[model samples]
Target: MTYEDIRVEHRGGVSTIVLSRPPVNAVTPRLLMEVLSALDDLEERGETRCVVLAGSGTKAFCAGADLKADNTLAAGDSFRDLGRAVVDRLEAFPKPVISAMRGWCVGGGFAIGLACDVRLASTTTRIRTGDAYLGVIPSWGMSLTRLTHFVGRNRALDLLILGEDLDAEAALQMGLVTRVIPEEDYDAELARIAERVAGGAPITFKAIKETIRAQYMYTPAAAQALETHWSDIGGASADMREGIAAFREKRQPVFRGC
Candidate 1:
């Protein structure tokens, strides 16, 4: 499907979704809706093994929400619903999603990157979540949850409440991003990482992704829901069986994502 504000390209089992709004790829409601739709398509296709999300230009992965468009909406459930729809779909995407960030990643843009399974940023990237400065709380709760778990609560609070921008190195130190590369090598590095991820066993990747997310998002009590899930599903998975068989046979295991 054609998208007005984004570009979707598929190659080598990796689907790259580019935020295409110029200057700074701000997340307008329409753009977010399109992203949700695109993710749905990718998941349903099952052919896509991985996804990379990036912006159209070098200046910014995204600056934030389109304040001009957002301001036009009345303050009520409609606004909340819009934001939740976008974030919820992103959080629920079945496949591994990577965010390749460059330049300014702020507010909603930062939230989107945080939602991804992995984030890689150029050395020049500046990351910030500035909802507090706008006299509002962050609507994307899971990102903060992840941040707090990855970093300490104090540092997460400092970044959120102080609205401090972190450079790529600082972001890595804070566990907000996985890697930072030079701007000159950013595209090549992103491509290599995406290719590696796409070539991995799909079922194993999905299981690992789900396990990490479950651990990151749940408390001891809440984790109970997943206890039976892994046993029932993972114990019977083809990849698990192949892994054991391969170990005995002293051969590489082939997985079909069953």
Candidate 2:
């Protein structure tokens, strides 16, 4: 499908989805839909083992909702519904997803990052859930839930209630981002990490993601059951045997999603 709000690029096993709505890549229903479409396309492609999300230009990864745009904040429920869909889909995506953020990442924008499996920030990045200060709450999917899960209740409360922006270092400390890279190294580091993640065994990666999400969604025993299920799937996969063979041969394993 043709996408106007986002650009999808494939490099080796990794697919990078760049938010194309410029000047901040603020969220809109169209943009959100485009993102969902890109994800659908990537997930079906066996070559796309990893996905990276980034924004256009140098301004911001995303500046949250385009307050000035129609069918956005003014449209109310429609915006909320789409926001929820995009973030929820990201959180549960079958393939690994990474958010490469720079400059401003606020409210729904930051929520998107939180939903990803990993978040990478540049030194210039500043993230916050600014709705509280506006006399509103985060209505974008599971923002608060993910935030609290990453940063503890106290830190989550501090960010939400105060509507303060956390710099890259602070975000890393709070576990909001996997790593903070210098502005100059941001792109290179993100590419390196994406390549590394993309090269990993797909079945193992999917199993790990599924198990981690299961822990939060199910009872302890149920979660364990899901883990065991995935364990069986992974253990019986050809990739597992290939991994073992590679280990014996002292060579890098080539994973074929099967």
Candidate 3:
């Protein structure tokens, strides 16, 4: 589908979906819709094994909702729902997904990155869940749960209630980002990481993602059971056999994503 608010680019087995609304790529209904649409397309593309989510330009990953937009306040509910959907979809995405973040990431934008399987931030990255300042909780896409899961209740509360800006280093300490790269190296590092994920066994990656997500909704025992179930599936895959053979041969295993 054609899109005005986003741009999709492909490199090898990875696809980068860029939030293209100029001037900080602020969240809007159209932008959210386009993101979901891009996910729909990528999910079905057999050649696209992984996705890298990013914002256009150097300014921001996303600046949360477009507060200054004419329809933002008028269509608050619509925007919130769309935001939730985008986050949920990203969290449950079958293939591995990475959030390549830089500049400002706030509220709904922060939620988006939290939903991704991994986040790689540039040195310039700044994150916040500043909904409290606006007299609202982060009602966009399970932000509270995701934040608490990542950083524990005390820290999540600190960030939410205080609404302090978190630099990339502080975010790394909080486990919000896997790593922070220098701005000059960020783009290449992001691509390298995306390529590595794309080269992994698809079924195993999907299973791993599903099992981890189960911990959020299921009891520990139930989650363990799910993990075992996925493990069994992975153990039976041809990729497993290929991996074993590759180990013996001391050669790289080429996974077909079965």
Best of the candidates, lDDT: 3
lDDT of 1 by residue, 55-93 (tens): 998999998877777442543455556666766666667
Off by over 4 Å in 2: none
lDDT of 2 by residue, 1-258 (tens): 788889999999999999989889998888998999889888899889999999997689999889888667676887788888898899889999999888899888888988899999899999988796777668775556766766778988888887887899998888888888899988889999999999899888878887788776666787788889988888888999999999999999998977
Candidate lDDT values, in order: 0.80, 0.86, 0.88
Cα RMSD, model 3: 1.2
RMSD of each: 2.7, 1.2, 1.2
lDDT of 2 at 102: 86
Higher-scoring candidate on lDDT, 1 or 2: 2
Q: Which stretches of candidate 3 lie over 4 Å from their true place?
A: none
If ranked by lDDT, best first, what sequence of candidates would result?
Answer: 3, 2, 1
**Cα-based TM-score, every candidate:** 0.87, 0.97, 0.96
Clash-forming residue pairs, model 2: none
Cα lDDT tens digits for candidate 3, 1-258: 789999999999999999998889998888889999999999999999999999999889988888888877678778888888998899889999999889999878899987899999999999988787898767874557777877899998888888999999999998999999999998888888899989888988888888888887667787799888888888888899998899999998898766
